[model samples]
Target: MPHPTGPRVRLRAGTRLRTTLALVLLAATLTVGAVGVVGVVATTSTAAEAPRTWVVDAVDDTSGNRWDSVDTGTSVVTIRVGDTVEWQFDRATQGHDLVSLAPSQPWETVWPTALQEYRDAGGPSVTYTFDQPGTYRYECSLHGPLMTGTIVVVPADSTNQPPTADPVVEPLTGPAPLVVHATANASDPDGDEVVVAWELGTGGAPTYTDHTMVEYTTPGTYVVRLRVSDSRGGLHVEEFPVTVTGTGGPGTDPPTDGALPAIDALAAPAQGTAPLAVAFSTQVTTRGEVHPYSVGLDDYPSIAGEAVLVRSRGRTHTTLSVTGTKPSARHGSVHVHEQACDDELGGAHFRLDTTQPFAEPNEIWPLFTSDASGASGLVEVTKAVRAGPQAVSVVVHDPDNAARRIGCADLAPGTADLTYSWAFGDGTTATGADPDHTYATPGTYTATVTVAHASGEHAGHATVSDAVTVVVGAAATSTPSPTPVPVVDGTPPRISRVGPVRTVRTSRPVVTARVRDAASVVSKKAIVIRVDGRRATKVRWDRARGIVRWRPAKALAPGRHVVRLVATDAAGNRAARRWRFVVRLR
Candidate 1:
């Protein structure tokens, strides 16, 4: 019997395994014909040449995991439009699905339009063809952002170009139960047939035509995206923001000086009176080591920036213009707060309206993304700055998960001198900027910083706090759970001295490898064999001798062959190795 983690269990030589429940029909139809699988197309051309197929592998859950970088397992490939890319998920222990993230939008994610998703009963291999040329970003829904891959599709023919989409969203802002209409007027330079699709960012199905009507019942900001594709494989994307106010909340609405949602309806709300030329900067550090193990902690560690704001006392608005270099193409949310870089970073959203809910209508959120040179342009949010101690900091948050603050910067203080205190997660406290908290125990910890602006112009009334979770090692088990994988075993098993290398004289070759873990190896048949990327069955494992062997169901072909073996430990840590061997003439 084959293990659940092995590549989709092979049946006979010609037949494949597929399930109706796990298949995704949004992108294309799945009809497993007699020859094989097909679903890719290209732009115009009589002699366009045959469409080539590309193969990409999904990192299995029992393998090295999503934490491993590219060369370890993750794949980033560049291809032409209409080319078919097949993704293999045979050893998918976690049952993963591939979904796209409206690549251009920062604070919004639409349920990926995919071909086939691997459920417990889904097919082992799924294929998708790029009908349009665009940079597509996708990730496994089960694993988070770290388990991600990118596909850059270019035009098959240069003369035939991609189309451009001009997305016009009407009534961009309004009260609760706001109804909005979004349309895309797209054109291709080559006068080719165009297909338009709109993703409403509401987790609902997308509209097929060039125009669609959507209703926004929620209060927060939503980014709607439009994709334009030409028959010749040229594609383009355009994004717009739509803000809907809540029925009622805590604060009042700031002035409409900066009422429009930033570039993509991401996070830009401006309300304030005058200008207070104050400037400050800070580096963007990823504080994402939460207990549950949030993804993308190390993705944007070096992304840094600063902001210049208008600060004053007793005003009902604040203007924040972001001016700095952020080298990352990915974006996060930015907000201005009353406190200067304390726990919660810049304090809560500096809201002038105490009755409105926590949203853009009453708060100041400026959104920005940089180019290749790290230039993030200007972002302004209008509101009354309380001068000195209040409204003096800007913080950037993760676009998908706001709890993760990726970057922060403080404003130039006016007459208020502040002191700082730090509390490391491991029961240790310190004064000033003490960077001496050495990490020994492997666990998840959230460090906090408190700022004090007492004794001067702002007495003891100006104390604030901010915290960013800095995760170390794996997901620690602080609380009790059914399975304690991270809490119990943190190390993966070790495999050494694999055999079946060079040339073998016999038609039946014996493959051998030694796999052992500090803890006991729980996998009864931990060894999985693959020949040239295709999963092979009938391979037997001899645990008594610590070696797995494989011979042909028939006779071996006389030539070079490659074998890939992946072994999983009791704790689910996986190791993989690939070796080549040859069968010669007798």
Candidate 2:
């Protein structure tokens, strides 16, 4: 047996024991020879045993410290007694020595200095076999505390054969609320029935099974264990490491003196008109700390709306109503944006106009308080800031650290009250949300409507209807009035010129088409071109010249290619043309 914390003595053959064994064997052989002419037979049997080997390497690299295990690349190793551990030095410019130290002992006093071995490039490897069950701490004397390692030794069983356990865990690292599937492949050499058990590091009753699933609610490193045992008292244990990471949830750091609460959710409107009255709702979770906080349209003394401070708990829910008067003068429109900073207290300001000073009094929206649980609020602006498609967003910030931004939301425009203006192609016009007009004499006419919103304007055409037509006498008389001429659109858009219509070897040859419509092209988006049945890449339309240009993103294969062009006009009329050309390899 070896001392619990001391190095074990190496096993070596002794001269005295060998001589005594040889003499006993010789005496037995002589006695058999003297007995008679009968032949004497000699047989020998010995039990076979070998020590397990583990390796560590020392290298001078920033990837890892000087001393790292060659097998696992970590500083820790677990082994049974009678297992050999070897340390090899591979750095040519640095010399390192492995020295054992007592618990809480100074590094200058390495116990049993005779056992320490220094090595460098081409140096001999040092080997040691542990014979005691205890944690052994060692370090490189040259590198001081920078290089350190630990070895955990277990006592070897001499009675029944111990079982072997192979443990596996999937997705060892992830965010909180992590689910890990743990399984073990265990076997007993003595053919004895083995029992497997699992224990989670979070402190719960151990589970008896070969396979089990465990979930971690908090963020931290958890040690999961698998144990196997035989009826004859042989046992084996293996460890699985799991790491969970996140800002909040269970298993996170316990509440400290100044730790901030977490915000769970926030809700509010994105856009509203003047005299906006907003109901802001919020939910937060605290870390067992007393956090008397306020909710309002902005942070602290500069708040433009309302701020109500209330005591919060592990889970808190509150709603605050914030109202603001709309600016009388509209310089330009300003967006209500939310900037989230969970780590710090500073965020960007809402600027409605460059000439106006940046202050919460001018802007009505709130900057959310930072919290890991997440915080929410609502704000109502009584007046419109600016018009014409203003961009709005909600910015989220960390409660504890206001400078850190954690999340955001881009708000969509609110519904608008619209006014419609209509033009009947029969030379008649009307204005109203919904207008009623009668045609006196009409054969065919195109009706169009233009709608105006608070921010912008849009126009669309109405479907043709039979109610608009009037028949004034079916037959012509001797003194009949002049007949009305019906408006007609019979001309289609014409393609003035097209290129690459013959042949080309370059795969990326440019294809151009000059198109024009008598009425007018609806938009550049109305033009489309395809090559070989596939849409061409980078299709651009030059509105000034009515030219559409496109090229293949990839080189065209060597073959005949078909190009198609489609164009549409404001009258809802469309024109299409197709042509073919050959592509040759260069």
Please state every model's RMSD to the true fold in angstroms.
28.7, 29.4
Q: Which digits, one per residue and each the tens of the lDDT, describe model 1 over residues 1-586?
A: 1111111212122111110001011222232222255542333422255455556665443222231222212244444545556666544433344555453432232323443243322345656665554565565533332244555455444444456555567776687788888778777666888777787767576777877898877554455656666654455554444556663321122212211111000001111112211111111111110111122236444433334443322322232222222455444455655444543334455444423333454556676675555445434444543322334456665544443555565544422234556675669766642233544555555566665553544556655554434434534448776763555766666555465576754344445455555444636477787886777787666453244546554345778888888888777888788889886533
TM-score of every model versus the real structure = 0.25, 0.26
Off by over 4 Å in 1: 1-134, 137-157, 164-167, 187-191, 247-586
Error of 1 at 120 (Å): 43
Query: RMSD of model 2, in Å?
Result: 29.4
**Candidate 2 regions with alpha-carbon error over 4 angstroms:** 1-68, 71-129, 133-160, 165-168, 203-205, 248-586
TM-score of 1: 0.25
Worst lDDT window (10 residues) for model 2?
A: 16-25
For candidate 2, write residues 184-292 as lDDT tens digits.
7878777989887777766687778888998887654565655576775455554455657663322111212222222111112211332222222222121110111
lDDT of each prediction vs. the true structure? 0.47, 0.44
How much is 334 displaced in model 2, in angstroms? 48
